[model samples]
Target: MALLEKLTPGSGSFDNREKIQNQAVSQTFHSAVNFVNHQYAKGCEHIDESTTVCDNDILKSLAFSQMLDRRCSIRKPHTSTCNWILETDAYKHWLQQSTGIFWLKGKPGAGKSTIMRFLYNRLRGECRRSPEKGIALEFFFCARGGELQRIPLGMLRALLNQLFRQDPTARQCIREQYEEKSSAFGYGERTWTWQPQELEVLLQDAIVTAAQTQPVTIFIDALDEAGAQFLSGLANYINQLTTAAKICISCRHYPTPPYIPGVEVRVENHNSGDIATFVNDRLKIGYLTEADSPDSMIWEDLKADLTKLAAGNFQWTDLIVPLVGTKIAEGESPEEVRRCLQIVPDKLGDTYRRILQNVIRQEDYSQTFLLFQWLCLAQRPLSVTEMRYALAAKDMVKSPHRIRCHETASFVKSDERMKRRVNAVSGGLAEVVQLLDGDKERQIVQFIHPSVNHFLLTEGLNLLSKLAGDGKELLAHQTSATEFTSNDTVQRCHSNLYRCCLNYLLSEETPIRTELGQVPGGSELDVRCKSSPWHEYATRFLFKHAEEAAKYRVEELDQGIWL
Candidate 1:
């Protein structure tokens, strides 16, 4: 009662009010501290208690971490079906299994890449389930970068990087591997250098270790662009890693890196079906309303036209589909669309050349044509950077030896001289020509598809032989004929041209091979030698009267023209 009186109102009441306020403040503080401690304990239950709970401000530190995990998660936009290739059961089966290296070889525009993209999406979904099922999917588009040129290693690194993001245990294993190697390095005071072969083995070991917990699958498109040596190395590596992982490779037929003895899929057989489906899909119900809905007569007619034009090539369909779609977009009648389809160029090279010719200036026509020829004859696809370097190097060689326009005209004093005299063009003229060449490199130095390369290299060489004759005559008629002599550059270029022609004649990778199998008569070499209608033209125009036509290889023919 005495304590209550001391805490009462007025003299005692004022003291009571202060005491009650102090107690309430102390209770509120204790409750807040207890709530925080409880949360801290809960958070530390799974984590080490020795580590301090980071402040709420640490949430800022995790923003980038969340972004890193989700950045690649955006699904690729769905491709329009106007040019979609059908996913066959055979392809689906190959996608599901993580065994052996499957090579998909076909000509350019054959829908190899399209099919690859489709399969990759399907496999990625499968990888999402049971991370322990050993399937981790990663894709490397070769044209996207030079890193892809490293093949299996580049592929393995990409896959492991993606897998590590989702599986902490796998990441820990990788860290442990690195630690063990570092410890070994420290103990021996020696460095470990891994050759491609050794690195492949180590990668296989890591992947197998991971697969024991989860399966991994890798998809590689444009194996041809990766280079033959890299492809061979990849095939060898795939053989070693077959038990734990699978790789799907897509490329053209010419450089089908040594056979891996597994399933092989051809894009040609799928072309007709895929093209038909694509055409039908594009002519949707509204677009086909005239007959019995878009699914009726108009749809069937468009598909039939596309099928005939496609001729077992997916690229043709791809180009034509877009053209038709554009016409439809422009409010052109279905009949107009059908007429355009009928005139769609049958030869891929001719079609590309027509498009290019229309786009470039007429005066630059010959230069562009010659540049394209050079690209077609190149041993491999050169990057835009590489092509630019090559062009600069070529120009550098020409600059020092270039003659003044008047000097060049005076040198060629004959009747032919009047027809092709050099003019005082801008120095930038050469640079502009080179720039145009470089532009092509950026688009991918695929001047023409492999099949077209074969056609041009064969027929093109014969055309060049004729041009060489004319060039030889013009040179002989020049006042400085004695001063001008064939040099290594000229000889080498000519030899390469001849070799390209010879290779095309002898190549076993032609479409007729499956039916002919080197029996000789049915081979390209045999046809060109004995039966081709062009043989008569070549013999009459290029071989007969060789001495009169300076372009003819009289001396070489005398020695024997080997196929």
Candidate 2:
């Protein structure tokens, strides 16, 4: 779609609109759209024959680039967790295997990803200890995070990227594919379609060509998050890879065991000691202090009770123990905190509700809820800076509400101030986490847990509706900013997001020149839009949100958009 955007009919070809005839303009517009559409269908471009560029590096990034540092990265084994997995004979054998897969399976919160990280770090250490291993590649997939993290094309590209980066000479065939794809073949008769099979062949050929004498291992987390077709293809391809390389994967148990020979390592059983240590450390953090307490149970008994309740699932313990500590810190006596823990639901959904109920304001629930809604519904993750501006935008066409934050974003000039505003807007529900994005670093606002997305979509929406009924006026604004659609919570969130984005876009005070040379008054400030992370999201997804919102509230849709 972005490729077609460059060919936008009359945009560049005939820029002097005042000089052009109406009929000519109309003809140019249709021609461009039609030409791009036809090219898109054919998967070809009409660029000059000599305009080819060596773009394999760009192709490698199509997915893998998005995969880099997409999370609050986990770099090592949990401090409280045991390292017995590394010492296990089964795991040791799996790692040493010339070719085959080591599959790690577990329930939702059984610390599978954590274990995967542990293994990845250990493998990295091995590579460092002995340089002959070349490089060990790792990728983590999140069902709730990004399109790249959950799709096959991205995963394949990530693998291909690793192969090319670790050993460039290995991708001779891939190099050819890259050149051919970019070449002006057949005078633009048929465009080169980037099918999954295309990369599959290159990857297979690249791995086959590596002639790696040193056994290398690849850790790919969350196969269950990827498409079934990709999963099956990967399973088959890796079967061939096992002849020289070892592959490891962590995912939720599904689709039965692989028919291909593989090593099965269950994460639940290995996590008991780790879970116990984690819980004990959490309890000792603040909940066990002698300063205040009504509960008489011994520390040992408390740990045992919590450990038993966790039932080999790290996620339940992860949320519950911290929640208890939070409650104790917030003025609830240790005795009262322990009492509440007794009734707190073991399920992840219940834990989320308890947390939200405590922190989410009943009066301004939808506005705050919109923050989470935008994070979940956004086509891509929004950074803390982006969310700050998003939360503050008020639709001018409507009876505009004055939402004055102590801080407002001037994206280029006020990045530091925006961080504080972002935290205020998040209200502790969403948070800013640093991700190691290749050579660069970035902060992204994401929910506490992957499961939080589902909770907000279903139970959380119901709670928002109930809370929105008697919500009070916003102290930050002249009147209450609780805008909610009674029947369509999802659409309302999207619509609100759409309006906010439009307001953000409209709020721009100046435009920049894209001419080859800078204009007299042009500075970095003039090119603020070019530097902002939110610019692309605003440009791409604004209308998508509005389009979706119109599905449920077409009449409520602002006519100003057309204008």
Candidate 3:
């Protein structure tokens, strides 16, 4: 009975025997496969070894190939003439020497980021071949307002994570460090007790330790967008890590990163060749080519003119290429195209205005103008979602109210009380309101760009003032209406009206300055102005009663100022 049971599939001894046999067959198969793979890999290594290729030779060939590919890929193709001249021998030597921080500064659209991208691609390829000798590279692109507020932490986390991925030992070391210093929250959790300075020191130490295993390179782009204080801190941190790591940073010249006592490369002043090369490459990619067969000759002529107009500015090339290409596709004459390109405005504002005019017509002019104005006056560069949200909110508050009416007397008179009640209800709305209007998903209500704000506040404001008038007429009309008749109501109405006027006049508060002057006698105003409280009411009263108080002819005067 026991022997019969053992022969069956349910017997424990029979199952053990079958398992051992299966394990033995699997091991043999795996061993044969691994041996074949090892032999093939060795053969491949021998072939590579016998090729007699130097690392520099490989690097140079790769660099040239990349440049050629880039030039070929661009629509309005031009030879990358600038690469050789701008990225000079001196700069190459400096990059090779493991400089801690290399700050490349330029104006907007100056091709700083493009050059960085090229360098990053080259370094990344070099790193992959010899992991032990190669540098660990980390890249951070500071987008407009996306994830920028937590810049330092965000950068550190990204860099550390990259390093950890490259080296398992480094990851283990980071884990140990966290466990040693941090509270009981397991590995990878940040310690609350660590101050910014301490955290920076810790990061520097960790990065240096990682570099000891392999060289490390960190690339940070758009430092200006990252905010001034954060950039300053980053510069200091990179300086601290100079002994072990290399950092390449790019930013606009306006808010340059703090002087970190390292190699500095100014893109605008020195990297014109790189910019020209980039423009030429972009042109090669059909960016300057005619789409239709009829305009082939015109496209060629337009390309030549555009190359000159770009003048080593990548932004100019980026803007003009599409326009010229489209015109050429439409069979425009080369001479006509050149003339049009020549007439195009040089400044960013002019370009923006041209684009605006093209997108909107006469009937939609007011909405578009107001949108531009709001963008110009905003505190920060808001996303499309934020801008839409803010606009919708403002519209809600300013929109006219509709009220229900009840029938009254034989005289067919309106219920004055009901009218007043409805008016009061409308007047009591909130200052800032939120609505899911427009594209609900985008939820924009803020300005398009920070520069737009500057433009609106200065040039746009002047233009709008001419169009909308001084606003005095609107104020007078509102004041004379029943809304401001009662003493209790007058103060609130006047204050609200003044606030609205101020908002229109000054998007941001400017410093206030007070001027004192004597008032003449026999004026309709009573200027019993005291110097005690420098309030808005006092300023308003003085200004409002200035004509009337002229009859008094006071020698002394007190003017109040507020921001």
Candidate 4:
């Protein structure tokens, strides 16, 4: 009332007084709008601050160098290969629904991971086009990758990292807990690492906070690769998350995860069309465009047979198609090509065995068997350069009296040459993967696929042992004379690696029992690390392998003397 009285003139002409009153009203209206704008700006600033906090050191601590290795390493779906899943009712319903879980199940090499990648990419595009809808998070399980990539802790870290990045409010929900831990313990990734249980709790809190503003969708591929022990717990936890967000997971048909109520899309049932399309695109039949061409009928029949034989297995189709193309390219008659395709074992396992026996030369059997043993049961995945040193040491171990580390490097092949050697020895079952670690490139050796690893561990190992006649111990499972179980066989593998580690450590090339003087910008230790690829691995994992080898007692190593 006082303000109003002040604004009105005490004595003035009526026209001037009315004009002054109107001006006062106009000024008040503008002031209110400006105040509201100021408050809104402050709110926005707070949100930005929260998001910025989430993007800082705390957030980075949750990530690791190999956290995204499997996810990014996955190959994108071929053109039009995964489109069929989009049109399925199960997929459509899952996408349109507000909240639920979806399961995509398939046999090994049936393209479950590929389909998961496709769906993730589609939702990612949708979110990009209309961000208000929600965000997408993905983690691909890799059994052959580093320990983190195959464990639950890694998955949670990856998902939470995405959630915190997308929703700043979500960061606030867990900030107190994070800070409390940080204060009680200490800072820095080296000092403190998040346990699996702690990560799970934080992930739950983050989802609840984020879901309040928008929906959340998660895609986890190759769940089976995470191992059987974690499957049930992971499924139950995923079920709980469905109440707050949508979840999708892919795994093999066997060792099925505990039942989580959701739509199940069996990839094999719906991938026939995709298989047919792939066959048509890959098979060399376009030149015989004329319906009456001499070879047209044969090519058509072969295409049909390939699709039918594939039985909805994309990997099988992928393998056979190239062989068919190769035969055609060599100017083989249509009948001969068709005959060759027919002989390829319909089952993937048999086909793998055929490949191994047919491609590897007789003289290379022993070395090849050793390579498979190293790949299948090594404590960790070996880099290509490390593998070269490892193989050389295996040869030198036969004559430990003449052990020379310098000679080992001389025998080591270039990365490309070693890659070809691995390919030849494993008969395409193993491959060398080049990865980027910061500014450096790393070449790692692994099986071509999970199924390949599966085969090698079981009947594949038995078969290789028989062909190579490497040793009686290699026949761990099948030999009735020696009643060693599969576990015993694995221990023997460890025993072999242990001996190799010992040989490498004792070599003259090793810089053991020496004080590394600190130099400007680097130390002698740094030089040794660069020059000696196997030295660090041997020292770090030597005792671990010895412990594993202890399970199956080696008669020579039983005595506390150098054999």
Poorest stretch of ten by lDDT in candidate 4: 473-482
User: Which candidate would rank higher by TM-score, 2 or 3?
Assistant: 2
- In model 2, where is the ten-residue run with the lowest total lDDT? 403-412
**Candidate 1 lDDT for residue 260:** 73
Backbone clash count for every predicted candidate, in the order shown: 15, 2, 45, 0
lDDT of 3 at 412: 13
In the range 375-419, model 1's lDDT, one tens digit per residue, is 554444444333332222222212234332223222223323211
Q: What is the full ranking by TM-score, best candidate first? A: 4, 2, 1, 3
Candidate 2 lDDT score at position 353: 67
**Stronger candidate by TM-score (1 vs 2):** 2
lDDT by residue (1-563, candidate 3, tens digit) is 64445446656654677668766866888899999867655522121332322222212211211222221232432345335423565457556775467777655555666766666666788788767555655444443334522356555555555565565446545544444443354323333333345446556777767776667787776566555456677766667777888777777653445677656665545645544455455555354443555556645555565555554456656666667556655657677667666433346555334323322233333334434444443333333333332222222223234211111111112234322222222111101223455565322233222333444444543443233232322221222322122222223322323333233222222122245422344221232222111123333432333333343432212323122
Cα lDDT of candidate 1 equals 0.46
Q: Rank the candidates by lDDT, best first.
A: 4, 2, 1, 3
* Per-residue lDDT of model 4, residues 384-441, tens digit only: 9888877776655445476665465335567778887886677556767777877988
Best candidate per TM-score, number?
4
TM-score: model 2 vs. ground truth: 0.50
Residue 152 local lDDT, model 2: 65
- Give the Å error, residue 373, model 3: 16
